[model samples]
Structure formats: C-alpha cells, structure tokens
Target: MTDIARIRLLTTVEHSLDAGQQVVSLANDEDPLTLKDRVGSIERIELHFPHFTDGRAYSQAYLLRRRLDFKGDLRATGDVLIDQLIQMERTGFSSAVLKEGVDPTDAERQFERFPAFYQSDVVNETPVLRRNTPES
Candidate 1:
C-alpha cells in the first residue's frame, strides 16, 4: 500500500492504454502524483482496491477528480463488485477490470438487484448525501 508498492505494480502490468502517458495502477496509500512528475504525464489511472471490504481507492479517485481535476480514464481494478459499478461511475471511474474469473455477461444483471441510490445521512465510503430528502 506504499508508493513504492504502487510503482512496482505499475511497472509490472503491460497493456494497451490511452496513449503516450503511462497507464498505471496506484495504491490508496501512495501520494497522488502531480501531472508534471508523472511519466509521459499519466493518461490513464488504475485504482486498486486490495479487497472489497477496503474502499480507499474510491476516495483516491474522488480526490483525483475534485481536487487534482484529473480528466482522463479512471479504471477500477481488483475486488470490484458488480453492485458497485454505478457508484464507481458516479465517483468518476470510466471503466473497471473485473477480478479474474468474474463473468462480464452476468455482472450487469447481478448489479441491478442493488438500489441505484441509497437513503442515508452518513458521509463515508460511497457517500450518500441528502438521504433525508424525499428525492433521495
């Protein structure tokens, strides 16, 4: 979960990505890399969630958008649940790499069983704002 760990993961993966900029996986604990410091200036960011019970990547992705203003591909990798896809999209993820052996065809169908929006007042992992209101 350290920056070094993230860098190591990035270096290990080989894939056809967005473009000249590196397409790399980042750990939740790693400090966000600024645009200038990134190799070839990162065009695609793959956020890793070590487990479904761990949601650090969601916050990482949110910060990348709301704070750093990253306007490129955001991909969720590892321990992705079918139920979380819509929220992931809402959180700014453009794509997801399903865990090994998870069927793509069944993912969407399974996802529909969960409510698209929740009714809650808490702000934590997967914030559900304005839950008290009827619109929520």
Candidate 2:
C-alpha cells in the first residue's frame, strides 16, 4: 500500500471515500446511513470513538457489516481503550489504533479474554445456538 493512501493524520471526520485511498476514517457522530450504498466499495473504513463513553460508533460498525455487508477492514480509532477491544472486534472492527498510553501487549491479552462468544456478532456471524457443530 502506498504511504499517501495508507498513512493519514486523521483528527476529524472529513474523509470522502475514493478509489485512491485504502482507508477512510469517520467521526463518532458521522452517520453511516448516509454512506450505505458506497460502503462496500471502500477497502477499509475506520470509525472513531472520540470518547470511551460514546457508543455511537458501535451502531455504525454493525450497520456497515450487517446492513451494508462491508467486508473489508473495519478499524477502530481514537480513544480506543483496552476494555473495548473485544467488543470492538465483536462489533466488526478488524483492527484498532489504541490511543497513547495504552500498552499494546496488555490490549492483545485483553482481546483474547473472551475466547467464545454467545450471540451472533460480526466476528462470528452465526449464533452459537444456530451453529451445526456441537457446543463446547
């Protein structure tokens, strides 16, 4: 990937998804509903959570995956805390850019805290009860 398209100093949500860029970062308040039709075309989309308490991005992630069927990179950016990584992954975030001060090793461990998920999520599209395989 070219640095021009791959590395961007994103501080806000002003990205206009284009063929040239591999990533598009959005703000917490930006509505994915407005971009539904073209979401599938983008190779990667990053949803920002400006604050740990703001949960709007969670819905945005779900809409992109379950509604728009966005199958590419869904990354989490800004204020990404250790406690939220697993949930972020469950909500369709393929990767994350943790804010300063959060240790990468600790975050990695936290992500593996839940080896099994129950409900149907982006990580496991099939609900445990609906799976054909036997339960653990």
Candidate 3:
C-alpha cells in the first residue's frame, strides 16, 4: 500500500483539527462529483455510512479521489467497522471514526493481518504483479 492511502484509525467522533481547515460533511446519498469546483478550497471531506450494510460512501470516496482528484483528507464517519478498514484504505479513506464499542486495537490488527493486496487501488494504480515485473 502507498503512504498516501494509509488509514488512520480513530476510536471517537471528536477530532481536533486546525482552526483554518475547512471540512464538508456529506450524507451517504450525496454525490462527491458535485463538489468538483470547491475541491481546492476544502481541506477535508467526511463521508457518512449510516449503516454497516450501506456502501454508498465507498463510491463517494472513489469519485472524490479518482474522479474529482480530491487530495485533502477523506474520512469515514458513522457505522464504521474493523472489518471494513482494509477495504476503506484501498478505496481512498485517509481516516475513519469507528462505531461505538469497536476496539481500535482490533481495527489496527486488521491492517497487520492483510498487509498487501494484488489489485490496484486509488493510491497505488499499478497492480502488484505489474509493479514487480520488468519489461521483457
């Protein structure tokens, strides 16, 4: 995984951010591409996951990263689970606020358990096999 896609695990919703940083929170149904014009001005974007079963936020994150090219922080909020962290990191979330009662330690272990992926991700466009192989 690339450094740009490293996921920061947060146990609580409360965050200490810089005073000047601009944050925009989007509901699960909101389309991230709509904010294409405002991407530069915003410093962070929070995408909501109303429930564990809902996956709209994943699409939003992909659009923001690959489509709109949002370079600032992308955070996952609400109903986040430890099992989703690996996929979340692959999709482009820089941080996630875990749901209540979910152990942060266990969430951290998820990364350790699956250290690498073969498929390409938003941060790492090259597939693992392609990255390792040299042109003949």
Top model number, lDDT: 3
Per-candidate TM-scores read 0.61, 0.76, 0.90
Q: Name every residue pair that clashes in candidate 2.
A: none
Using TM-score as the measure, name the better of candidate 1 and candidate 2: 2
**Model 1 lDDT, full chain set:** 0.60
Give the runs in model 3 whose Cα sits over 4 Å from its true position: 1-5, 16-20
Q: In candidate 2, where is summed lDDT lowest over 10 consecutive residues? A: 1-10
Q: How well does candidate 2 score on lDDT at residue 52? A: 94
Clashing pairs in 1: none
Q: Write the per-residue lDDT of candidate 3 for residues 22-68, one digit (tens) a residue.
A: 89999998878889999988888999989999999999998898888
What lDDT does candidate 3 reach at residue 4? 76
* Residue 58 miss distance in model 3 (angstroms): 0.4
Write the residue-wise lDDT of candidate 1 on 18-128 in tens digits.
344557778878766554355336678888878888888877777776667676677787787777765666566766776666666666665456544553211123335
lDDT of candidates 1 onward, in order: 0.60, 0.71, 0.85
Residue 51 CA displacement from its true place in model 1, Å = 0.7
